[model samples]
Target: METRLSLRYTGPAVDEGLMDVYQASANMIAFSEFMVTAVKATFGDAADAKANVAGFGKGSFITDLVFSVGGPAATIFASFTSDHLVTVLQEAFGLWKHLKGSPPTEVNQSGQSVSVTNNTGQIIQVQTDTLNLVFSEKGADSVGRFIKDALNQTGITGVEIASKGEPVAHVAQHEADYFVPVAKESPVSENVVTMALILVAPVFQDGNKWRFSDGTGTSSFSAAIEDQTFIARVNNGERFGKGDVLTVEMRIVQTRTSNKISVERVVLRVLEHREAAQQPSLV
Candidate 1:
């Protein structure tokens, strides 16, 4: 069955300086994408390159490169299905953790504050030591893994069916409307299941206009709205506009023969007003 997984980048709108910082953060995200490609490349099956591939791959062979320019890091999505969904997702989590930081710190003790560094080196101290480590193998499994495993646990046995498809590609330009499947019905045949992942990014424009789309359609917000110093939502959609803030939210969903699981990673970016001074604003 087909399994889909998606990653999204959301944050405040962009100004020239803020764009520079987002570009730096994009490097780390690009590294994570590279790790995903490298892991999938090792699998046999020429079709494997096409099937379990990353968004940046092109040409005949799947390349372990991400080509999209950094612009308010966007979301990412991927999906696949096999009896070994657990094993595959486990490997993915291993690679993701190796590339990203360890799942948010887990506080054995409560009320104790800990220092966590953002993409920027600035260290921020939180009041609680109980960092919600969402993607823990023992705790809450990776969303992708959770979905895949959930389907597998149904106990309805089936044969292993494989298919050859093109390697997934990432969209270069931003879109306002897109569809990402969050869940799916049971598999038709035994041991077979299908799933999909959706990556979404919010875009805002000048005059307080904003929209949310993913290489598909566009949806507008009400008016230019500001929560704190950042623009929250313009019309009604999630995309950010020029002079508005942008936020990227990454979520992974997995579907198994019987169950499903999901996990999310959220990052924020504040687009500085081009006319504003260079001082950093509070988040």
Candidate 2:
């Protein structure tokens, strides 16, 4: 079974402490959603994917504030959920930390570097300095997942080439416009922001229709089957099949404020199960 998990930031009432804070919040939400989409692309189901300790479900899974105060500077807490949530989270955070510093410098090596004009009629010149692009290790995986998910969410499909063979494929590439950075500012009070995520995976048959458990009460399936398949792919590198149930979980976190509203940290939890029980076969 395959399922889709999504997150959307409705936008805050106030721009808040720093322009970056509001921006960071928006970016985080987008990034988190992107991560979920990536899991769906990789696992084909949210349930089959690994989840946080928190849990998973439908409706709005939100993290209003990880840490909040009346002031401009406050810590923020946030999280995301899906199958492979832990691994994805770890990678995302790692990348974030890695790229938190200054942007790298790039230079042109060819002689007679000349200025050129683009279709927009904007003049550009090549630099002679070495470029130093840095990516955050803290949220690397998460960010990658986010970008990956964003591409899949676009509804585009294709074949992915591999050394072993051709697998069902999808493509997601990042553009400069898609990149948003965390902002910096001092806080007025000790406010905090918190975030929570829910992963839901629906069960389905060959036709992509929802699947239900047999009346015999032996095998069971539910919304979480997708998540389970995700986790299975992460752990075993396999895809989910019919009659599987996905498990959903959540990850919550709170962090001390500094400048940005990025995820300070997160902890996960499992919520509910919609699958049936397994029974012995009748001879």
The local distance difference test score of each candidate is 0.29, 0.30
List where candidate 2 sits over 4 angstroms from the true fold.
Answer: 1-16, 20-25, 45-83, 95-283
How do the predictions measure up, each by TM-score?
0.18, 0.19
Best by lDDT: 2
lDDT (10s digit) by residue, model 1, range 1-283: 2333333222232211232344333433432343334324222112122233345211112212222212232122122223233234334333233324322222233354444443334444432211222222222333322222222322311111111342222221121111112122233322211211122223355444233223234442222223434544334554433333333332222334213443222222334322212468898
Encode model 2's per-residue lDDT on 1-283: one tens digit a residue: 1223323212121122222344434444654444444344323332222222122222112222111122222121113222233344333223223233222222233563323332334433432110101122223334433343333332222112111122212222333122233222223333322222222233233223233343455543322222444444435543444444433342223332232343222112223333334477998
Each model's number of backbone clashes?
65, 88
lDDT of 1: 0.29
In TM-score terms, candidate 1 sits at 0.18
**Quick one: best TM-score, which candidate?**
2
RMSD of 1: 23.2
